[model samples]
Target chain A: MPRPAVEFWFEFASTYSYLSVMRIERVAEAAGVEVAWKPFLLGPVFLALGWNDSPFNIYPPKGRYMWRDLERLAMKEGLPFHRPSRFPRNGLLAARVALVGVEAGWVAPFARAVMTANFAEDREIGEAAVIEDILRALGLPADEVMARAQADANKLALRCQTERAAELGLFGAPSFRVGEELFWGNDRLEDALAWACAGAA
Target chain B: MPRPAVEFWFEFASTYSYLSVMRIERVAEAAGVEVAWKPFLLGPVFLALGWNDSPFNIYPPKGRYMWRDLERLAMKEGLPFHRPSRFPRNGLLAARVALVGVEAGWVAPFARAVMTANFAEDREIGEAAVIEDILRALGLPADEVMARAQADANKLALRCQTERAAELGLFGAPSFRVGEELFWGNDRLEDALAWACAGAA
Candidate 1:
């Protein structure tokens, strides 16, 4: 029988997504659960909900609590966290590159590197140069991959993937889907894996 | 030195707040942390957020997930849960009565009973009769307490408490504050107690 599996739906601009991407691999491997890395845009999702920007920005208190919560959570995980000057920095370019990386079997490493660069080093992952640097560091052909990522077909594929996410009733990042069971937020990672494992039975 | 303490800020109509209310006292007791129950209304908070109704009502997907999450969580705790017909029943009267309970040293029981009635019994907690029933169950004078709860001073006091919650940057229910460190959501109860204990040092 095939191993139990979960689709990890994440957005590059999501703070909780950064937390999940950094640690999901080890946990998934330990649980014998296959990880399907799904990089999608939250922009369209928010727009559908009548939010022109991240809810964190639209609601200042939630935004403030989120940054502090992220910092505390990162510290507990021993992961370096630096608040970016820009909130919800365009993850468009990074998501595109991550799609390329997902197909190249370097999704985990590439996603983690991008998150670290953006969240820890205060670097912008939205820039094509930053994404190119991430791809090159992974020993992939940056020029070829970048060209393929920006191709009309690949762009359309990402759009369809995001639409699928919306159809799945996803309204936030770092969501996990185990079969038909959906677990939202970074805090639900464990619960999602447990659901997947239970389903395997 | 006195034991470390944390204030548990909750709303009667909040689904997650029900979960936290049911479990927090035992957890706090086990951790040797003192808990200060602070019941406040989320109506004002949401209004200040420019939302006329609960975000769950505005966002169907989120609302759907919250109910499912609450049911699952409630079952895990061996607690009964029935979905109330109303999304967010009027918590105004309950909050006012809770303030009265706070001074009478019956805050925890009063809050838990109201949550159970709303989430587990499908009762309308907004009704004065329901609040009176809960108060009488606690052996408090239902008529007198209900009358005192509606006094102009008590009404204004509840308003002040909600305003204080807003000033503290609260955006959601079931929040915990250990001095200035705020932990939001039911999942953070354990962490909040830990933070309180650490602060005692």
Candidate 2:
């Protein structure tokens, strides 16, 4: 029989996504569940809600609370987290490169490295050099991967993937999906995995 | 030293607040913590953010996900939950009467009753009769309490409490505060209590 699977829908620029990406593999593996790393942009989803940027940026108080909350949560989780110099740094290039990783079976490490660089190290994820360095560090072919990720076909594939997220009624990340059930935010990770392990019964 | 205390800032109309209200006292008692229930309005807070109504109402997709999430969470918590016919039924009257309950030393039960009526029973909390019913059921003087709750002085007090919440940078309901630290959402209840017990060290 096939292992129970859960789709982890995340946006690279989402703080909560950073938390989920850093630890999902360990938890899913322990629970004997398979995880599919689905990278998608929250920009378009926010635009559909009449927001031009992360809601955390659009609302000052929420933004302040979010950073403090992240700091506390990261400390509790024993993870290194630094408030990025730029809020919602463009994840366009990183997300596209993530798709390339997904196809090559290296999505987990590449995605975690990107998140660590953007959030913990305050690097610009949108820059090609940053992404290429991450790829090269993983012993992957950087130039070839970048070229493939930038292709019209790969770009269209990412767009279609985001549309699927919208169709599933997702407005935030990191969201978890098992069959028809959708769980939003990093806090719901365990519940989603448990549901997946239950085989949707 | 006195038992560690935490202020639970909540709005009567918040769905997550319903979840928190149902079980906070038990958990707080077991954790050797003191909880001060502060009933405040979210309407003013949303207004400050240029929203005329609940953000859940303004954002349709979010609103949709919230109800489903509430249902699943409530079920898991062994709490009965019904989707109220109205979204964010005006908690103005309820908040005011709750202050009267606070004075009479019936705050906890009165506040929990209001939440139960709105969420588990699908009742309209905005109506005076409903408030009267809840107050009377608790063996409190319904007419006198309602009259006092309507007085200009009492109304002003509730308004001031809501303003205090905003001053503290609270942007939503079911938020817990321990000194300078603020924990938002129902998921953080235990963490907030733990922080309070740790005495801000």
Separate DockQ for every predicted complex: 0.86, 0.93
TM-score of each: 0.98, 0.98
Model 2 DockQ vs. reference = 0.93
Q: Ten consecutive residues with minimal summed lDDT in candidate 1 chain A?
A: A92-101
For candidate 1, write residues A1-201 as lDDT tens digits. Answer: 668999999999999999999999999999989999999999999999999999999989999999999999999999999999898899887888889788888889999999999899999888999888888888989999899899998899899999999999999999999988889999999999889998998
Q: What would the per-residue lDDT of candidate 2 be over residues B76-184, giving only the tens digit for each residue?
A: 9999998998888999999999887777788889989999999999999999999999988998889999999999999999999999999999999999999899999
Over B17-94, each residue of candidate 1 has an lDDT whose tens digit, in order, gives 999999998999999999998999999998999989998998999998888888878887998899998878999999
After TM-score superposition, the amount by which residue B29's alpha carbon in candidate 2 deviates from its true location, in angstroms, is: 0.8
DockQ leader: 2
Could you tell me the lDDT of residue A168 within candidate 2? 93
Candidate 2 i-RMS: 0.5
Give the per-residue lDDT of model 2 (tens digit) for A1-201.
678899999989999999999999999999988999999999999999999989898999999999999999999999999899998998988889999888999999998999999889999998999999999999999999999999999999999999999999999999999989999999999999999988844
